[model samples]
Target: MNFNFLDKLSPEYRNYKIERIKNGASKKLFFKISKGSDSFVCTDFNSDKLEYKNHLVVHRILSNIDISIPTLIEKNDDKLIIVSEDFGNLRYDKILKQQSIKDLLQYATDTLCIINKEINFNPTYTLPQYNIELFKNEIAELPQYYFSYNNIIDRIDSLNDEFFDIWIESFKQLNFNFKHFVHKDFNMNNLIFLPSREGHLKCGVIDYQNSFWGESSWDLFSLLEDSRIFFTDQYNAYFMNYFYSHSNQLISLKEFKLKYHLLNCSRQTRLLGRWVKLANELNQPWYLDFISTTKLRLQSSLAILQNNKLTKFYDKYIL
Candidate 1:
């Protein structure tokens, strides 16, 4: 777990003290490097499966476009470690508690709209595409943790069948532009609030390198339907209205809601399995704490979407 390659690469960090940050679900490890008054976050991606380079590329693109992304200070390609400007431990949720949830949602909504407005579609960022099949495959893991593991589904095969069937029907509804910067992990925890900066830069974004090619609404839902915090009805309404109006009717509210609900269900369901995987495989039991809230959010979306396929599956296990 010693990721001192940053110190070896840069003499300034030779005296840096490394402290681990334990908030992420990914297998990659994060460390805080402290050298008296100077500080930077170092990420260690031990897994070759995860393309850490994508985040670095995104940092380059977003930084040039005026987005407040962490500035990449140093990186060692062979070590799979990256050192970037530390935004500190300030999270959007912490600000939400001190300020106003509704107010923060509006600011956050404005940030999302900026991505839609400013970031180009196929601007040669060269990131991966989040196609429908990739979306379906991610949702397919839900049955194991949400239904079968919970004893809601009787058979593994049946669980897989229901999981794919519901998602396939839901995926058909998305006639996305597939030409926007989609921050796949946009949420309170990953967002950093900086009061001193102006406009969207006031909100420094982290964990945004996991972005992809898709309709911008994918991120809007990721922000509003976040499972970490139970957003009030007012917060939800304000966010939807603000984004719809701000984007100049980019997508119809009706169609956006349809995509929003189903995408949230897909995301929440995928997260349920992700939490279980972290707890069981990674021995990170703290992930279990978020399961109930995530499940409730998933259920809420499923209830409203009213897909008979998912509705039947839900009643069988979740009810």
Candidate 2:
């Protein structure tokens, strides 16, 4: 947790002392630099070069759309930093822990509405437009962390081949038409809650370096189905209804439900793989705690797909 990088800053930047913020899943070291009128956030990026670049692109794009995020401060050869409007230490998740359930859902609904308005639907950056072959190719390249975890390999082998085949084929049949810029990690942990003019909640988005042209529901799923915070069913229903009502061209309820389930499954599977890789390869065992949660999600998705409703579809192609 020692962020010695702040000490390496040039004399001009040295005035910005480092403040350790131990709130995120990733290692975050916030640098509080003294600018005449504003304080900037200097977060470290140990991710690959492409990931760093993507983070900048997302920050710029979202900022241009008037989405409330920290302003990009500067990017040196080694560090990426941004000067943002300081919204103190009130993360949405922390607020939920102390606030009413109704307030949490209201904020969630409003946040999604803002995102839907800000993002333009563009297919090129969307995940659904990624063809099945490409999807398989990308997933196939994913390391053994996904398939070989504790008893996960056994589970995969035990699962009926017919079910697995259908799972792959069903992925191809899914409709991917709706596309928009998604804050890939739009969970509560990354959102800051500030008091609005009316004394209600105003949200500021963060950690969007992973933003991409993807499903409109990606962010929603990330927020509602967050592993760290549990949302009530009533709140979830209210939020979903609010989103569908506001979206001018929303998907059918059936399609929406399908996509929601499928995407959740896909995300959890990827997360499981990532956790295992982090533990075995990166030597980060902190990720192991998420494996069971991810496994349950995967199992739930599989059960949903196995329903009698989709049996014919499964038999014809998957079996």
Worst 10 residues of 2 by lDDT: 310-319
Residue pair clashes in candidate 1: none
Q: Which regions of candidate 2 deviate over 4 angstroms? A: 1-4, 7-12, 22-39, 74-80, 122-134, 137-143, 152-164, 196-201, 295-319
For residue 90, model 1's alpha carbon misses the true position, in angstroms, by: 1.3
* Per-model TM against the reference: 0.89, 0.76
User: Each candidate: what lDDT?
Assistant: 0.75, 0.61
Encode model 1's per-residue lDDT on 1-319: one tens digit a residue.
4444544456777667888788465677788888878989988766742568887777777776656788889888887878889998778877666866665666677778877777776657778887888887787666656555576645678667766876787688577667778888888888888777876677778887678887767888788777777656556766776787777346678877777788788888788877777788778688777788887787777777887877787666653
Model 1 scores a C-alpha lDDT of 0.75
Error of 2 at 168 (Å): 2.0
RMSD of each: 2.5, 5.0
- Candidate 2 per-residue lDDT over residues 80-126, each given as its tens digit: 44445566667877877586757655665566666677667654442
